[model samples]
Structure formats: C-alpha cells, structure tokens
Target: MDAIFIQILNGLDKGGAYALIALGLTLVFGTLGVVNFAHGALFMLGAFCAVTTQKLLTISKHVQDTSITFFDAYKDQPYLEIWWGDFGRTIIDWSVPLSILLTIPAMLLIGLSMERGLIRHFYKRSHAEQILMTFGLAIVLQEIIRSIFGANPIPTPAPDIIAGSAPIGALFGLDEALVYPWWRLIYLLFSIITVSGVFAFLQLTTFGMVVRAGMHDRETVGLLGINVERRFTVVFGLAAVVTGLAGAMYAPILSPDYHMGMDFLVLSFIVVVVGGMGSLRGAVAAGFLLGLLQSFASMNEVKTIIPGIDQIIIYLVAVVIILVRPRGLMGRKGVMED
Candidate 1:
C-alpha cells in the first residue's frame, strides 16, 4: 500500500513535467497551425537559464593561498561571498528559484526571435518542412548549448531547506515510511498553478479569447481588423515561455544537459498526440494518464508479468488510444484531421 501510494505520487510528479511541455506544444499547434519540433530546445534553454543565473551569482576571484598548498595556488572565492558574506551565500543557495525571473525574459526574447526570424517564413509550409526545419533548428540549438556549456549534465539542486524528503503518508494516518521529495511536491504544485493559470487566461481574459478565436477562425478574426498574426506571434512566444519555465523549475529534478531537449521531445510529442493534437485539456489529461501507467508499469510485480513494460508502456498506450479514437480523447473534428 505504501509503495502504491508513493508510485502514484511519483507518476503525478513525472506527469507534471510531461503536461507542462505538452501544454506548450498544444499552444503553438493550436494557435499557429505549425508543428514545432524545436519546442524541446526551448525547454533546454530554460534549464540553461537557471544554470546561467547560478554562474552569474557565483562569479569568483582567485586568491593565492600558500598555507593551503605547498606551492602557491589560488583558491576561488565567489564575488558574492566576498561582498555580502552570508547574504551572498543565501542568494547563491537560492539560485534555482531566483533564476525563474531571469528565465522569463530570456525565453520570451528567444521565442519571439525564433518566430519572427525563422518560423514566420515557414508558416504556410507543409508539416514535413516544418518538422525538418524545426528539427534541424533543435539540433543547432543543442550544438550551441553544447559548445557553451559542454555535453555533460550540470547539477542544479533544490534549496537546502526543502532538499530533504517529506513524510506525506502521515497526512493519511499511514506510517511515516512513505516519504517523498519536497522539491517534487513543490514542482507538482507549480505545475497545477501554471496549468490553471493558462486555462484561466484562455477562458476568462479578452486577450486569451482573441487568441482562441484566432485558433478557430483565424481568417474571420483577421477580417474583423484584429492583428491575428501579431497575436499568434505572442502566443508562440508564450508557448516557448511555458516550456522554458517548466525546464527551469525542473533543473533540480533532472540535471540540465545539451541532449535533455531531445530526450523529452519524443515523449512530449507522444503526449500531445495521445491528448489530441490541438486540445490543451487533452494534453494535460493524457500526460498524467500515461505518467501513471508508466509509474505502475515499473513495479517489480508488473514488470515480472510483462517484461520491460516500464520502458514501453507509454508507447503501447499511445497505439491503443490512437486505434480506438483516431481523433484522440478530445480532439476537434477538423483541427488536425486533414
């Protein structure tokens, strides 16, 4: 029972990431009618944003220390520590959270630039062209990151206060043995808030309504004298921001690496497809559903019955869902039918 509870929690945590990435994918597809294969690169860029923040905060000066080493050698001391002492240390310690503010503007600009400079040219092109171009763009982005940050994974840890496990089972009057990471719980809450916020923006706000109108009948919205093109550009940027923020928050969970974008790209696309190509709600639902199945499939008992099921559960489920409902769980009639 304890294991089952923990697994469910694990599934939700993993699903949060999947949903966040897929949500961004849905936004771009729904609004721009373009299949963006480079969305994962935006996520990788976000994680790097956190990394950049940490580096900026920890800029160091080397001082010679003859006592420490037999030969005179310089010891690195972060400028923050020298200037502010404890306060500077605190800032460095909380770099991950602080990076969120930095990531927003960086991602927004990158997104807008990509849309205006490259994606704009391919708006009317076929899916294959979009895929090829965006996929190539993703590779280029990854190579650039690799050149700057190297190919190795860089560790980004949660703050000290919340770094340990929380005994969540106690809330249900279960034994305290069922512990979960505090950062994972925080991430899940963050995902819920972000997803809700996006939904609210679309359902309640005028800007979101305009965006939604553009998604459904872009020509009609343009005919009404609204700059649908500009709105779509903003939506594309917003999608990049969404994906970027997800990556930034996730840095502590998974180390940031150049290939991280490629790693999530396929799974996220599968999630988008399973959720229904252009359905935001569908993306969120399917992400969690597949995440849960993935968690359950990894159990020793389940894996014993179905060998290597954990590795292939998500794909298997995708096939079944596609076969049963070609339009996906909640896909619109003509969104991606053609």
Candidate 2:
C-alpha cells in the first residue's frame, strides 16, 4: 500500500509536466491547425529564462579579501550582494522563483514573433511542410541555445525554505519513509492550478468564447466581423506561454539542458496522439494515465516479471490505444482520422 501510494505521487509528478506540455501542444493545434514541432524549443527557452535570471542575479566581481584567503587569493561576491548586501543575496537565493517574471514576457514575445514572422506564412501549407519547417526551427533554436549556454545541464535549485523532502506518508497516516521532494509536490499543485485556470479562462471569458468559436468555425466567426486570424495568433502565443511556464517551473526539478526539450517533445507527442489530437481534455487525461502506467511498470515486481517493461511501457500503451481507438481516446469523428 505504501509503495503504491508513493508510485502514485511519482506518477502524478511526472504527469504534471507531460500534461502541461501536451495541453499547450493541443492549444496550438486546435487554434492554428499548425503542427508546431518547435513547441519543445519554446519549453527549452523558458528553462533558459530561469537560468538567465539566475545568472543575471549572480553577476559577480573578484575582490581581494584579506579576511579569507584559503582557497583563492580573491573572493567572488555577486554584484547584487556586493551592492545591496543581504537583500541582493536573498534575490540571488530565490532566483528560480523570481525568474517566473522574466519567463512570461519573454515567452509571449517569442511566441508572437514566431507566429507573425514565420508560422503565419505556412498555415495554409501541408502538414509535412509545417513539420519540416518547424522541426528545422526547433533545431535552430536549440543550436542557438547551445551556442550561448553550452550543451551542459544547468541546475536551478528551489528556494532554501522548501529545498528538502516532504514526509508525504505522514499526511496519509503511513510510514514516514515514503517521502517525496517538496518541489515535486509544489509542481503538482502548480500544474493543477495552471490547468484549471486555462480551462476557466476559456469557458468563462468572452474572449475565450470568441476564440472557441473561431477554432470551430473560423469562416463563420470571421463573417460575424471578428478577427479570427489575430485571435488565433494570440492563442498560439498563449500556448507558447503555457509551455514556457511549464519549463520554467520544471527547471528546479530537472536541470535545464540544451537537449531537454527534445527529450520531452517525443513523449509529449506520444501523449497527444494517445489522448486524441486537438482534444485538451484528452491530452490531460492520457498524460496522467501513461504516467501512472509507467510508474507501475517501473516497480521491482513488475520489472522482475517483464524485464525492462518500464522503458517500453509508455510506447506500448500508446500503440495499444492507437490500434484500438484509431483517432485517439477522445478524438472527434474526423479530426486526425481525416
């Protein structure tokens, strides 16, 4: 029972990131009908946004410290600390949290630019063309990041107050040995909140109504004197922002690296396919389902029975779902099937 609970928590943690990325992918596909292969690159850029903020906060200068000269002749003090003392140190220490401010605007601008300058031109093009061009763009973005930040993973830690593991089992009246990372719990909550907010925004707001209408029948909405194209552009930007924020939050959980986006991209694509393309609810559902299955497959008992089942579990599930549903778990009549 304890092991089962722990694995459930682990699965939810993994699923949160998967669902968030897949949600954004669905938004872009539903709104613009564009296969955005570069969506993962946007995620990578968001993680880098956190990294960049950390770097900016910790800009340092070498100074001679007569009080301490054991390791080096000069001591490095972050400019923020050197200038503002404890407050600057606080900011530097909380770099991960503070970076959210930087990521939002950065991702919005990047999304808008990509849509206006590049993706807009290819909307009427074939999916193959869209895939090729976006894939190329993703490669280019990743290469640019590599050139700037290098190929190594950069660790961005959570705040000191929540840096350790949480005794999750205690909350459920179980053994304390079943502990989970505090940040992972926070991430799970954050993902839930974000997903809820998006749904609420779309369901309750007038703008959301317009966007939804445009998505279903663009020509009809445009005939009603609405700028469907502009709304679609904004939707694309919103999708970028969603994916970017997910990446930003995940930086502390997994170190940000140039290739991290590519790693998640394939899995997220599988998630979307299994969930049903263009279905927001399906994406979220499939993400958690696969996440749980993967978690159980990793159990020692399961692995003992079927060696290496953990690795292939997700793909196996995807294939089964695809073969059974064809269009996906919740896909409409003529979505990807057409």
Candidate 3:
C-alpha cells in the first residue's frame, strides 16, 4: 500500500505537466481551429529558458586550485586564484526557484511573438498546411535551441530549502528509499495552482467570458462588435505562457534539454485526445489518470505480466478511451468538424 501511494504521487506530478501541455493544445485547437505543432516546441523553449537562466546565473570564474588541506601543495610556489573574479557558485547555491520565475515573462514574450508573427497568418490555413508549417517551425525552434545550448541534458538545481528527497514514506514511519523529492511535490502543487488559476480566469473573468464566446462562435462575437481576433491572440499568448510555465517548473524534476519537448509532445496529444479535444476538465483528469497508470506500469509486477508495459501504457489507455467515447470524454458535437 505504501509503495502504491508513492507511485501515485510520482504519477501526479508527471501527469500534471502532461495535463497542462494538453490543455494548451486543446485551447489552441478549441478556440482557433488550428492544430499547433509548435505547442510542444513552446514547452521545449520553456525548459530551455531554465537552461538559459541557469547558464546566465552562473558566475563562471577560472580557478587555480592548490589543495587547501595540504600546505605542501603551494610548495611548488604556484599560486591559485579564483578567476571570473567573482563568486559564481554563490548565486547559484543561493537561488534556483528565482530563475524559474524569471523564465515566465521571458516565455510569455516568446509566446506572444510566435503568435503575432507566425500563427496569426495560419488562422485560416488548411489543417494540413498548418500542421506542416508549425511542425517545421518546431523543428526550427528545436534546432535553434540545440545550436545555442547544445544537446546535453541541463540540470536545473532545486532551491536549497527543498533540495533533497522528501521521504514521503519516512513521514509514515516506513523505509528510507521510498522518499519523494521536494521538487516533485512542489511541481504537483504548482501545476494545480496554474490549472486552478486558468480555470478560475475562464470561469470568473469577463475576458474569459469573451474568449469562451469566441471559442464557440468567432463570427457571432465579431457581429456583436467584440475584438474577437485580439482576444484570441491574447489567449494564444496565455496558452503559450501556461505551457511554458509548466515546462519551466518541470525542468528541475525532469532535466531540461532541447529534445525534451519532443518527448512530451506525443503524450500531451494523447492526453488531449483522451480528455476530449476541447474540454479543459477532461484534460486535467485524463492527465492524472494516464500519469498514474503509467507510473504503475513501470512496476516489476505490472511489467512482468505485460512486458514492456511502460511504453504501451499510454497508447493502450488512448485506444480504450477513444473506443469507449468517440468524441472524447467531453467533446461537443460539431467541434470535431468535418
């Protein structure tokens, strides 16, 4: 039971990232009728933001080291001095969460620019064309990040306060190895807050009301003199920022690398499909469900029975869900279009 509980916690955080990513994809599809292949790239970019911020924060200084513990180390008369002339390690050791925060506005701007400059032109393009264009864009974006940051997995160090394994099992007076890391718990909470805020914004705000209306009928809303297009652009940027924030926060739990987005993009699509192509609630629920199940599938017992269950868990769930509900858990009629 304890083992199961820990796995459940692990899944929630992983699934939360998926849910958030899928939600953004659904938003773009639901509101704009365009399938954004760039969504995952945005996610990738968000992770890279952390990578960039970490690199930016590093106070790199060349240091000559003579073993301070050994007095004879300087017997060769070689003097060691810290170069870059500053304490580069001090700032990094002090704050990591701050970089994630700095990543938000940066990602939001990136999102806005992508929307205004590229996606705006595709609002009326055919789905196939949009996919091709955006996929190409994603490729370009990934390559750009790779060129700049290299292909290595970038480690995002957690804040000093929450730097180690949390011992979830230890809290229950169990064993030591069953500990959960604080960064992951923080991730789960952060995703929840983000999901909640977006939900609340849509449910409680006038702007959200307008956006929802625009989602249903851009033509009708335009007829009523609403700036439907402008709201959509805002929403696009919002979706980008949301996904970017998710990616940025996720960087610590999962390594931030240029290719990480490609890994997440497929599952996110599956999550959206299983949740319902346009349903936010469905996306959130399905993300957790799939994440939990996937976590369980990796267990020795489950894998022994199903062999390679980890790789197949999501696809299996997607198949069953799609078969059970053709339009998704909450898809509206005609939203899938012809």
Would you list the clashing residue pairs of candidate 3? 59-88
User: Which pairs of residues clash in candidate 2, taking residues 3 or more apart in a chain or in different chains?
Assistant: none
Put down candidate 2 lDDT per residue, 60-117, tens digits, no spaces: 9998877875865788889999899989888998998898899989999999999999
Higher-lDDT candidate of 2 and 3 = 2
Sort all candidates by TM-score, best to worst. Answer: 2, 1, 3
CA RMSD, predictions in order: 1.5, 1.4, 4.0
lDDT of 2 at 261: 86
| lDDT tens per residue, model 1, 152-183 | 99999889989999988787788878788999
Q: Which sections of candidate 2 miss by over 4 Å?
A: 69-72
**What's model 1's lDDT at 25?**
96
Q: Which ten contiguous residues of candidate 3 have the minimum total lDDT?
A: 76-85
How far residue 213's Cα lies from its native spot in candidate 3, in Å, is: 1.4
The collision pairs in model 1 are none
Encode model 3's per-residue lDDT on 65-147: one tens digit a residue. Answer: 45676553333211111332234345555345666677678877887788899989998889899999998999999999999
- For model 3 the local lDDT of residue 30 reads 82
